[model samples]
Target: MPGIHITDIEAAINFWRERRPSADGFTLALPVQALASLYARMVFQRQDLADEQAFSAAAWAAWQTWYASTPDTPCIAICSTSQGDAVCKGCGRTESEVQYWPEMGPAEKRSTWRRITAEGTAWRFNRYAERARETQRSNAGNS
Candidate 1:
């Protein structure tokens, strides 16, 4: 089973913190409390990943709630995986990821997103974005 990375937990914590900030500086929002408890345990245990099956009901529920708020995919509608690229130039997803995205779980999708975002090599983040503007400029100049 794919373990939940600590970074994902941290992101979820931040999400809940923003969505449900405590009225007082001392107290945590319910979802934040739930996820924070999990985060605390992970830190205390010195574990970088958490077992999904081991999650407490509240932790799982809190995580699910946070997950729902995140974007589902990183697709910029410029898929290069269609032309047989092992990794998509546009979205920065592996061909397997593109093929199986519909079936991937929230955690799996998030993991892919984390990797792609960290790499920052996707065309959508770089050249492909500039290329679109250039194309528009070319069209405007022609007319």
Candidate 2:
């Protein structure tokens, strides 16, 4: 439910168009490409996806390689928002962002991630850089 975005679908379509183009103007793989295209159309045309689960699965398949390399959450097992900080000193998210994180779409999450990293005020961003890298490496190895 909280997976790929329309931008991701568009990127995949572009990649396929450039790297795996077909002579007949159809993608080399119709099913997944068509699914992603449908999702992109739904998003850009301001329509809801008819089947979110199916679309998520198809988008995951289409974007799995990129997904694997994406950064993990910025949380460092500490949350200052719960301790009454409006902007979390632990991870740099606002209280509202922390409260609504699970419901956030990929694009929203990425935007928050960018802001936190750029601000570099959170303990997780500044003091825990090595810890974050270690955790990422550990998670990647496990995967």
Candidate 3:
């Protein structure tokens, strides 16, 4: 399984910490502490101090929990695949990926998201990322 990003782990740690003081003696507190420790080891590049399998499992669980609140989709509504393009110029997903998106599992979708973002070849990420961000900011401000 792909590990959560360092930044995400950091965010999760903050999330847990913010709720920790009020969570004393609770079942969730132990897991939250464990997660924080594991995340800290990862951030400091000290994987040797922790079990990799354990860390992966904990991170995956934490990621799933966090992602439930903000499920992301890569579609920017300009799919070139609809016009018979093999790869979408907008989102960089292939025709098959676009067709199977609704059926793809979370891991598969995340893999595609990571690929597109890393490649940075799509119009969404390359040519219009700033514009998209600005638009999102504008929309958020209005809301």
Candidate 4:
């Protein structure tokens, strides 16, 4: 998951599975709809590149905005991936949410991100946090 982190990816996949299994398979996987939106955004932002620097820059900018948000994750604490059953008790996301996350269009992706971020209020730091921490720690160690 380039645009999103692994935990978020797992959470999202689990979220979607609660509603229904994908037509193709029961186990949900990556390559969701939103990744395309990320690619498109990267291209649009002129940050699209196979290089590490491009990825670092894009990831940093994205993370900074999301992580600093007061609310973060907008999750109502009703996770769908719980063992009891499919479908989140709190959020309405389901298998489709997982399947569609990577391929969603820009508008759709933005909407999803907004919801996930709770309109810049809530932020979930899974991948970005790890990355930021590692970078800072490494930098400190180096300095």
Q: Pick the candidate with the highest TM-score.
A: 1
lDDT, residue 116, candidate 3: 87
lDDT of 1 by residue, 7-103 (tens): 8889888988898888988899877888889899999999987888757888899898878887888888888889888999989999999999999
Model 2 residue 111 CA deviation in Å:
0.6
Pairs that collide in candidate 3 are none
Task: Please identify model 2 stretches exceeding 4 Å from their true place.
Answer: 1-61, 68-72, 130-143
In model 2, which residue pairs have backbone atoms overlapping below 3 Å? none
Compared with the true structure, all predictions reach lDDT values of: 0.86, 0.67, 0.70, 0.43
RMSD of model 4 against the true structure? 17.8
lDDT of 2 by residue, 69-120 (tens): 4665777778988889899888999999989888976656766876787898
Q: Residue 8 deviation, candidate 3, in Å?
A: 6.5
Compared with the true structure, what per-residue lDDT tens digits does model 3 show for residues 36-98? 767667757854223335565655576567656555778889999999999999999999999
Ten-residue region with minimum lDDT total, candidate 3: 46-55
lDDT score, candidate 1: 0.86
User: Model 4, 1-143: lDDT tens per residue?
Assistant: 13343333334334434444566874332333333334455556765232323334544444333334323222455455464435433444454553465675333443455455553322133544456688999999999
- Candidate 4 local lDDT, residue 20: 43
In model 2, the worst 10-residue window by lDDT is 47-56
Better of 2 and 3 by TM-score: 3
Q: In angstroms, give how far residue 52 of model 4 lies from its true place.
A: 32
TM-score, candidate 2, is 0.48
